[model samples]
Target: MVAVKITTVSTRLRRSMRAHDDYAVRVGRRRLLVTVTAHPGVARRWVHTTLWRHARRLRSVDGITVGMGVQWTPPFRAMKYGAEPRPCTLQLCVGHRCLVFQLAHAGAVPAVLRRFLADARAAFVAYGVRSDCRKLEEHHGLKVARGVELRRLTGMGNASMERMQCRS
Candidate 1:
């Protein structure tokens, strides 16, 4: 097992008012250091300085792993028909790094992230990718140009990767 280190980017900002937090996590040979931020500037800087830099060294065969979750605005709200839930988080893992973006706090998706998702050379791998792509476009106006559905590749049903692996 690897240790995880977490630290705040700005000590001057109050805990509740801080825009983001930095996390340094190690999993196997991967070193995932990402800043969870809703600020567009911070997110763009991270993408250009860290994500794109790392992506340059990766081969085309090594694709990015994507995951996301949706949440209701009101925590205890009853489900309403035809209402679309907002995406709360988006996680992008590639090579040795993984970035987790707090979408609920971000008023709009960062241009850098949108560019990444639209990059034709980068292949995103996720379960239920079509649904994820649709939700992203509908809510944030972000388009995913290319992606591969893990379920289709593996011939798995609705079960997640974790649950499927556990069964095996």
Candidate 2:
């Protein structure tokens, strides 16, 4: 059976407690956020397919949006505890001079996480990002989509105190 993988990318809107999460590509000042989740084997396959399909289109320096919805679990749980859905959603934000991409597919092995990363890496370079693909690939487990921005994050880049505090 085909397996499914889920991933996300986002950016920080403001350095405030109430900053909103921007999951689209747009001209703005914020940090780039990305997340990839899948069983190791399946993730490899999906990532490969995704990167091969969209690499060429991302050869620009302008921000673009890409979103993919796959079976997944929310980062956290809320009131009911463990009430999050199994088939979760994944989103990301490349930035003003960035591009966003989403992939929703099913599979057992060779998930789509790799493809998503590869495309993102190409896009990042198109936007003038001087990053190392190998390092990013190793660190993130998935292939390097664009820039190695994730390598720059020290803590939870996507997790916001306000959002976390909000009703999950």
Candidate 3:
């Protein structure tokens, strides 16, 4: 992945806010909101691939370097657990140190998925980012970051401003 410096400054301001998907990535000072299909695996793949494929072009508009490659880390069990836990892992090295999000199923993985993960990981390493998310976090916390969890939200379509919501 490549990096770019943000330069465009918006002068016109509007009070209206448009709805957007929860997942997004930030490189340099620019933010991108992209839509991916709901499947975690497919979403993960698209995130990395899309960034890499469009990095150069994107840089022209935003003055950043986006690289085409993925670095996927091996799945590890969570630190605490009574029973089995869902696999939470990372994909990296797409577009200047970007990491793709994903969820892995239990037991052995299929060969194709394994290969994709490995390829992504290798590409990530090739781009020189520390593929481990925890290491990255420990080193740099809450800097140019975005995340989403299955939290409860009350809303009708885009009518979220006045809704009350609860989650467990």
Of the candidates shown, which would achieve the greatest TM-score relative to the real structure? 1
Q: With candidate 2 superimposed using the best TM-score fit, by how many Å does residue 66's alpha carbon deviate from the native?
A: 1.7
User: Could you arrange the candidates by TM-score from highest to lowest?
Assistant: 1, 3, 2
lDDT of 3: 0.35
For model 1, what is the alpha-carbon lDDT of residue 137? 80
Model 2 residue 48 CA deviation in Å: 1.2
Kindly report which residue pairs in candidate 3 clash with one another. 1-96, 2-96, 4-64, 70-120, 70-124, 71-120, 71-121, 71-124, 72-120, 72-121
**Worst 10-residue lDDT window, candidate 1:** 8-17
Tens digit per residue, CA lDDT, model 1, 1-168: 434454333222222327677766654445566566777776777677655575754345654454433333554676688766766677776654456677878877778889988876666778778877787788788788887787766777778866655544
Q: Candidate 3: list runs displaced more than 4 Å.
A: 1-22, 25-28, 32-41, 44-87, 96-99, 104-113, 120-122, 126-168
75: Cα error in model 3, Å? 15
Better of 1 and 3 by lDDT: 1
- After TM-score superposition, the amount by which residue 152's alpha carbon in candidate 2 deviates from its true location, in angstroms, is 25
Alpha-carbon runs more than 4 Å astray in model 1: 1-17, 28-30, 54-75, 155-159
Q: Provide the RMSD of all predictions against the true structure, rounded to 1 decimal.
A: 6.6, 15.4, 16.5
Please give the ranking of all candidate structures by lDDT, highest first, separated by commas. Answer: 1, 2, 3
For the record, the alpha-carbon RMSD of candidate 1 to the native fold, in angstroms, is 6.6
**Candidate with more favorable, higher TM-score: 1 or 3:** 1
Instruction: Decide which is better by lDDT, 1 or 2.
Output: 1
Report the C-alpha displacement of residue 115, candidate 1, in angstroms.
1.4
lDDT of 2 by residue, 8-111 (tens): 44444432222122233222334443333333443453345444555565565643344322224354645365343333323333332222222223233234
